[model samples]
Target: MHASATRLPSAAAWTVGDITVRRIDEIALPPQTGPWLLPGATPEVVSQLPWLKPDFADETNVLRLASHSFALTVDGMRVLIDTGIGNAKTRANPAWHDLDTDYLTRLAAIGFTPESVDLVLLTHLHTDHVGWNTRAEGGSWVPTFPNARYLTTRTEWDFWSTTELDEPRTQMFRDSIHPIRDAGLLDVVDVSAEGTTVAPGLTLLPTPGHTPGQVAVRIDSRGATALVTGDCVHHPVQLADDALGSCVDIDPEQATATRRALLASLAGTDTLVLGSHFPAPTAGHVVTDGDAYRFLPYGM
Candidate 1:
């Protein structure tokens, strides 16, 4: 375990009709390689920004968890929103491959089984987002949810599958994506052309920004709604300064507009908000904090 993970609280869960959403855990990559996804401004830029601060977590807390993934269960379907960095995979960053957290086991506590997953919804194809897309099997990568169909945005697939993808992100296309495609289980979603109804009460909202074809998932039942804001707005800081962009974002300006639009949609309703990368127990609602906004955690 990393030194920072020790301070994390246990995982938490929430339900929307037949859909049960769980905030898996928190994740942090070193600041040097890239800026954290939300408000992905460079450290120097972050330092200069008026809203930026040195620390976002409690100093006494040892775990510095930041990113997150969610598991979604609806009707008879068990689905995972995004897979966090998986264990025992070799990466350019030595620290990344060495991570060995017990996220799957944690899922078991809430009645989820790896085999039980019916679909895996990937907002986009990023290394961290698809780590658990497959697992090691017979010395080769195999689908993590063998019975599930791995969904990716169509535009994202068209981009990454082409030579246009840069080196750093290209391997992610190979390592996490190719295997599923080879296995005949990858589903490319047309977020622009059609709105897919994967199961009852679940909908895919095309909220692109952080990536070319990024998307958000919405769960509604009996007028109660929840928007699973995949990477629409990574951190609360983005709400404060629309110009600040996460380091890895392909287009910062578009990302800002997407964030603002999402915030506006979730502003005054009881609609629950969930993020793929927020603090642990990642399900929460955004409320105005000062001139900006703050993430209000749902009861753990």
Candidate 2:
């Protein structure tokens, strides 16, 4: 069991039929992170989208982003999606290197204790998404959720395992990914053209391009549907124009195509679009706006 040293307040959860998905708030990304991550979302572009102001962006129209995990229970199984930048981990990115947050406490608030989690889903093996896979333990890194199966796509693991990683990425793997694998907790699943259903009403939809194996998690129940967009759609601004690409996108053109297609599929539908990085009121419905689409905040 992961020890809860302290407690912190967490955000609200939205219901998708019987399941209640809560956002375990980590640190809100600094203002600079927005511009750096999605440089194309300039003041002029973001401001033009009137719906993005006051909540999704600042007065200057700088995007608002966050690092968080989505926790929910399905069939008595506790599932956590995309662990955030963990506590006290070394990283080349100053924003992510060796920090502290109340992420664990937030998860526990939603009944997601480390030992109790059955599945830790990784949309891709990105540093931020996988940082919490391991925790500092007696001068060494160990699996944070020792009992849970840390899962990702087979393609993702294959790509990273064979690719030559730079020092920074290698350091992340050494501390985060490697420890989980070494402890025999990592599980790689094959995401097919039709998508893979991990559990009842929970399917992993292939949304490649952010990375070759990125996935968007879909939840369906009681005739309702919700999609947890991993990095496929980083923010609401992207909905306004698919051309606004993230700087970190592995394959820019493919990423844009995936985002565009996903948005098109969700527009004018009832599917609840849950953005993995959207700052607040992250759950919403995608609706068509002019030539592109726009995100209509949930219950709004």
Candidate 3:
């Protein structure tokens, strides 16, 4: 952990009917300038979205972005949505390189340990999303959740395993992903199906373009619904302006289209939207705001 790490409150949980979704934070970042993070998120543009103030943005209008994971508990199983950057891993970005945090400790506090996790789902095989899939053990990487089965789309697995990646990213695969497969615990599913059901009320919806096989988890129970957005819409600002795209998107045009379509489908509906990188109070509902859309965060 960083010496100046900020201590956030205990993980918060929200219920969609009988299922409970909990947030376990790895890091809550300080304000980051709009232009630096999202080119289209200029000061002038972000300033106009007054709804961003306080929670999503600060007084100066800098956007707040965090890296965390969600725990979905139902049907007598513990499902981890995405694993944030793990401890002692080699990363290209200095900020993410070789470090430590009490991610598992926090999970334990919320009544889960590595072994207790029944399933580990990765929206995509990005460095940040798959970091905790494995951990350093006696100078070798090993699956962190010994008993859990890690799930990834067949398309995603094929793409990453065969495509040439940079040294750092390749290292990410070596340390976090391959070990799980080596342990005979990784399962590649067909995401092209109408919906891939992980449990009774939980399903995976393909929302490619952030990565070729990226997916979003949809939960429906007792008529209550929620969508776990996996970088499809990184920030609430994207909801207000569909033209803006993430600087790191693999296919910007496809990503933008996916975001617009996803937002359009859920706008004005009651489906809860939980963003993978959204700041605190990350659960919300997407509502139509004029020709564009806006994120109506929970409790606001």
Candidate 4:
């Protein structure tokens, strides 16, 4: 019932066998960051695709859209795929600071607590992706979930920790990653192989290009599998046109390649696609709509 005025709520879940599935919370749609300047964009091409509304005009008038994140519950462990924007932090821009996040509380409402989380899987090192990695401890930033092991790909960890980033992205690592590392809770993982199973059924599938070592998590349990697409395909509209990469994409060509291949493999299978920025209940299946495929949001 928490549907955005400009978007609809869609969720469909069933056990792969014994694993429980749930979409914990969304980051909510952010307000437009630019003035409307496009001229060729048509309403017909925009409004028809719910995910394309942001590209047409501001939807903030009607929708309280936020970013998206997912919780994959397997065994007795609750694995959070990605952490949305953290509550408060310093950045190059004020917009990224002072945001509200009730993530831990939200998880608790669904019977998950910080201690119930055994692993925190970071798809990449973007600020928004790692916001909840730490919390204020006395006068220091400490691991938010002292009991959880935060997992990040070795490639990503090496690059961000070593590379010199602009003020914003640099601040991101300083806040979300450094603190966890200092706390001895950050795990640098090598997921360069086909995939690596962090737990019994949760695997990290490398889907780099959004960043050097970006990855999407695949969870298999009870004969069911779900792909947390991270930022491989930020908006569902990209599935229709793989050439369109986001401004933040580090390698547009590679990202497009990664997106298509991943979506194709899950197109007609039992695999459910979970996109990081897709609308809440951000999961669905791909269906052929003539030459282009369309996303059918799961209905539960």
**Each prediction's Cα lDDT score?**
0.67, 0.87, 0.85, 0.69
Superposition error at 249 for model 2 (Å): 1.0
The top-ranked prediction according to lDDT is: 2
Instruction: Say what the RMSD of model 3 is.
Output: 4.9
Cα lDDT, model 3, residue 267: 93
Clashing pairs in 1: 4-63, 40-245, 40-246, 40-247, 68-277
| lDDT leaderboard ranking | 2, 3, 4, 1
**In candidate 4, what are the lDDT values of residues 145-208, reduced to their tens digit?**
7899999999988887788788878778778888888888889999955998888888999987
Model 4: worst 10 consecutive residues (lDDT sum): 1-10
Better of 1 and 2 by TM-score: 2
TM-score of each predicted structure versus truth: 0.82, 0.96, 0.94, 0.85
Compared with the true structure, what per-residue lDDT tens digits does model 2 show for residues 126-190?
98898889899999999889889888999899999999999999998999998889889999999
Q: In lDDT terms, how accurate is model 1?
A: 0.67
lDDT of 3 by residue, 61-166 (tens): 7788888998978788899998988899888766578868889898998888999999998999998899999988898999999999999999898998789898
Model 1 RMSD in Å is: 5.6
The parts of candidate 2 lying over 4 Å away from their true place are 1-9
Where in model 3 is the C-alpha error above 4 Å?
1-9, 30-36
